[model samples]
Target chain A: AQKVTQAQTEISVVEKEDVTLDCVYETRDTTYYLFWYKQPPSGELVFLIRRNSFDEQNEISGRYSWNFQKSTSSFNFTITASQVVDSAVYFCALSEGTYSSASKIIFGSGTRLSIRP
Target chain B: NAGVTQTPKFRILKIGQSMTLQCTQDMNHNYMYWYRQDPGMGLKLIYYSVGAGITDKGEVPNGYNVSRSTTEDFPLRLELAAPSQTSVYFCASRYTGTDNEQFFGPGTRLTVL
Candidate 1:
């Protein structure tokens, strides 16, 4: 079985503040993939990032960064200098199955982040 | 590219009514999926198609049906609509590869009364 938990239901931050959203996952498979997606108020999901199981290295893209720690089964996302445009619901997803078998993904409850400009 | 597209941006259904949500992808992706999002909740997989003539159920497939008769089209069918079934439906598609990144549609908001 595989599960992803996002403890933070909602968070609000003012402009320029840095915010970190926490995500924890559970999976028995040695090979897996982790993903971060953002759903704006318009109700469209936008893919943010994807990381494989073996890659524990941190990733940064402009104002966005992701920290994947296999030891803790945690993949945390951070936003530097947050803006109103960053306000959205972020989800963490996990996939652990053979492509020929079950390659579907399981998603967390999601964390709603509100940024005020 | 149009990527993935879903028809009927919004719809209203009466109890016991049935309707089909249409999805199309021009990306020529081998994998297509249907997910539903409730208010303040993450999307839940309803069904997915690996290729034409191959479809499988996902986490929440009850009360829903899907068919993939063509590579560019996968439509989800809902029988006897219920209030609990009201949600925002999304269609996504991805090419065959290890990367497995999915592109999503704008989503269809369904309201049942």
Candidate 2:
């Protein structure tokens, strides 16, 4: 069985604050994929990043960053100086297998982040 | 490119009615999927197609059906509309590669009464 847990249901922070959203996953497969997606008020999902099992490197894109630790089975996302435009719901997902035999993505319940200015 | 597109952005259906949610992608992706998201919840996979003419059930496929006769389109069919089936349906497509991320459609919001 594969599961992705995002315990934070909601988080509110003032503008320019740094916030981190935690994601923990459970999967027996040695090779799997992790993902982060953002859903703004537009009601459409926007893909943020995808990390494979072999890569444990932390990634930074502008004010957003992701820390992937395979040992703890955790992929945490952080936003530096979060602005009002950053208010949205974030989701963490997991999938098993390589390119050919990859399974469907299993998404966590999601965490809604509110950045108030 | 159009990426992935879904029809009828919003729809209201009465109980027992049948409808098909259309999805089309121009990316020439080999894998396509259908997922439903309830209010304030994550997406639950309903069905997926690996290639043309090959379809499989996902985590939740009881109230839905899907077909993949072509690589560019995968449509989900709802046989009998029920209140429990009311949700926002999303269609996604991805190329057969390790680094490729699934491209999602705008999604269809359905309400069953």
Best by DockQ: 2
- How many angstroms is residue B88 displaced in model 2 relative to the true structure, after the best TM-score fit? 0.3
Query: On residues B1-113, what C-alpha lDDT tens digit does candidate 1 reach at each position?
Result: 88889999999999999999999999888899999999888889999989999999899999999999999999999999999999999998877764767788999999999
After TM-score superposition, the amount by which residue B18's alpha carbon in candidate 1 deviates from its true location, in angstroms, is 0.7
- List, in the given order, the native-contact fraction of each candidate: 0.42, 0.68
lDDT by residue (A1-117, candidate 2, tens digit) is 999999999999999999999999999999899999999989999999999999999999999999999989999999999999999999999989887874689999999999999
User: Which 10 successive residues of model 2 chain A have the least lDDT summed?
Assistant: A95-104
True-vs-predicted CA distance for residue B46, candidate 2, Å: 0.1
Clashing residue pairs found in predicted model 2: none
Best by lDDT: 2
Per-model CA lDDT versus the true structure: 0.92, 0.95
Q: Give me the runs in candidate 1 sitting further than 4 Å from their true place.
A: A98-102
Chain A structural similarity (TM-score) per candidate?
A: 0.96, 0.98
Judge candidate 2 at residue B21 and give its lDDT: 99
